[model samples]
Target chain A: MRKTFITAILLVLAAFTARAQTQEPEMADALRANGKIYVVVTVLATIFAGIIIFLVRLDRKMTKIEKNN
Target chain B: MRTWWWKILCILLVGYTVIAGFLIPVPRLDILNETIRNLYFHVPMWFTMIALFTASGIYAIKYLRSGRLQDDIYSAHYAITGIAFSVYGMLTGMEWAKFTWGEAWSNDPKQLGSAMCMLIYFAYLVLRNGLKDEEKRAKISAVYNIFAYALMIPLIFILPRMVDSLHPGNGGNPAFKQYDLDSNMRLVFYPAVTGWMLLGFWMATLRIRLHLYRFKKENSFAFENN
Candidate 1:
């Protein structure tokens, strides 16, 4: 009976450790590893750059209009 | 060239925000997981809106004091830009909430408060359009803008804190600062806010310039006749 109780406690401890290992929060580790994350970063940066260019052009046009007036 | 410096800074900072916001390491937590990055993007929209609205309110006060139609134009354009930012804030918030909070419209206190705040500002626009006379519209709307700004403070910032709210930094929930807004995130977050605020200001200035141009063109005959 003593041996059986010891075995049961050991099994529970092992299960707890296993659960803890698996319980680590999910993140985009796989994407980072494969470097697909950079693709997303590049896409966003390109879009932002495009917007900046548009704003700059508009500002120049406005300046020309103001000068003419 | 000197005047264009801030616009250049705005572009650089926002460009940095886009690149670093994605690549930078962030704290990992359940549920919030990757969506935690939304803090950099989503939260800045509200900050920009608040900044624009504050500018609008100040211009409104200036209009009241000086009775200058130019001040009214500045105030109106600022408010319009502010409303645009608020709409972006609301939509991004809803998208984030749908995935995290399990519903797009959870009727969260902060959400309801901001919605009410938007409606009040929308009424400001409606009030301006309802009148045809320029002076009357400016005077009445200036007063209303002051009232709207006063009400917005309590609705968006104070009321959410007074009640139980799911939003961070409100009610019982700890703000990001207390838990997960680590030093790393702050590096990108602060710049993101500055960049977005500048961008909103730039857009408002563009509208103000356009309006001013039109106003000048319309009144040029008066100046020539004089």
Candidate 2:
């Protein structure tokens, strides 16, 4: 009886693991695994930072013009 | 208007959005796949546009109440900035749709409504520019702006919900909130909207300041003679 109980518990655990694997839809696991996604993230962040810097400079120029006015 | 804190916050929030938006774990769905991350970038454009347009409408009311050209300048610049954001929203939405929806221009109810909304605002600009007299232009456009804003509410918000739309949150389609926009996404989504709205406001303020400078320059001689 104890052997049968152990076998049932092991079977249930195996089914849960198999379902977890098959149920998951495809994601960027390959890109993430190879770590190339970080490259894209870095490029985007850099471009955004550049835009922010440009805006700040423009804001300062506007302030200077306003002061002279 | 020149406060630095919110600008700084905008930078921080948007920067965080870019990083966390890409890194965060999203729901593993079949069709959406990785494009679910577009939620952080795409939806915020519309939110920012709406916020800017709302500001434009408020400034229009203020202009009518005070008969101040400065308020008119504020109104026009806010509308212009809002339109710019809308262009971005449309472009990004189309790009996302092309991949996921199998085509870009599917004549979706939401798309048609937004297109019509843009055309109405464009006509408002044309109407303003056609009047050479400054006072008349400001007053007429201010009234038109109020009407345009009133029309926008139903076209973009109400009509889309009333009809069947391929866009989520409308028709029989389940909204992102029903499934995809879980707590993990909300943390990034709300901040993304706030950051983009702040950035749009900053751009509008800069344009308003430039317009004010020109107005002062032109009127300076009159003041000096007095």
DockQ of each: 0.54, 0.58
Q: Write down the lDDT of every candidate, Cα atoms only.
A: 0.94, 0.93
Model 1: residues >4 Å from true position, as ranges? A1-22
Poorest stretch of ten by lDDT in candidate 1 chain B: B1-10
Candidate 2 residues B1-226, lDDT tens each?
3688999999999999999999888888878899999999999999998999999999999999999999999999999999999899999999999988999999999999999999999998899889999999999999999999999999898999998998988878888999889999999999998998989998989999999999988899789999
DockQ class, candidate 1: medium
Q: Which stretches of model 2 miss by more than 4 angstroms?
A: A1-23
lDDT of 1 by residue, A1-69 (tens): 999999999999999989987898899999999999999998888888888889888989999999988
For every candidate, give the share of true A-B contacts it also has: 0.77, 0.77
Give the alpha carbon lDDT tens digit for every residue of B1-226 in model 1: 2289899889888888999998999988888999999998899999999999999999999999999999999999999999999999999999999988899999999999999999999999999999999999999999999999999999999999999988899999899999999999999999999999999999999999999888888789779889
Evaluate residue A59 in candidate 2 and report its C-alpha lDDT on the 0 to 100 scale. 93
Clash counts per candidate, in order, are 0, 0
Question: How does residue B66 of candidate 1 score in lDDT?
Answer: 100
RMSD (CA, angstroms), candidate 1:
4.2
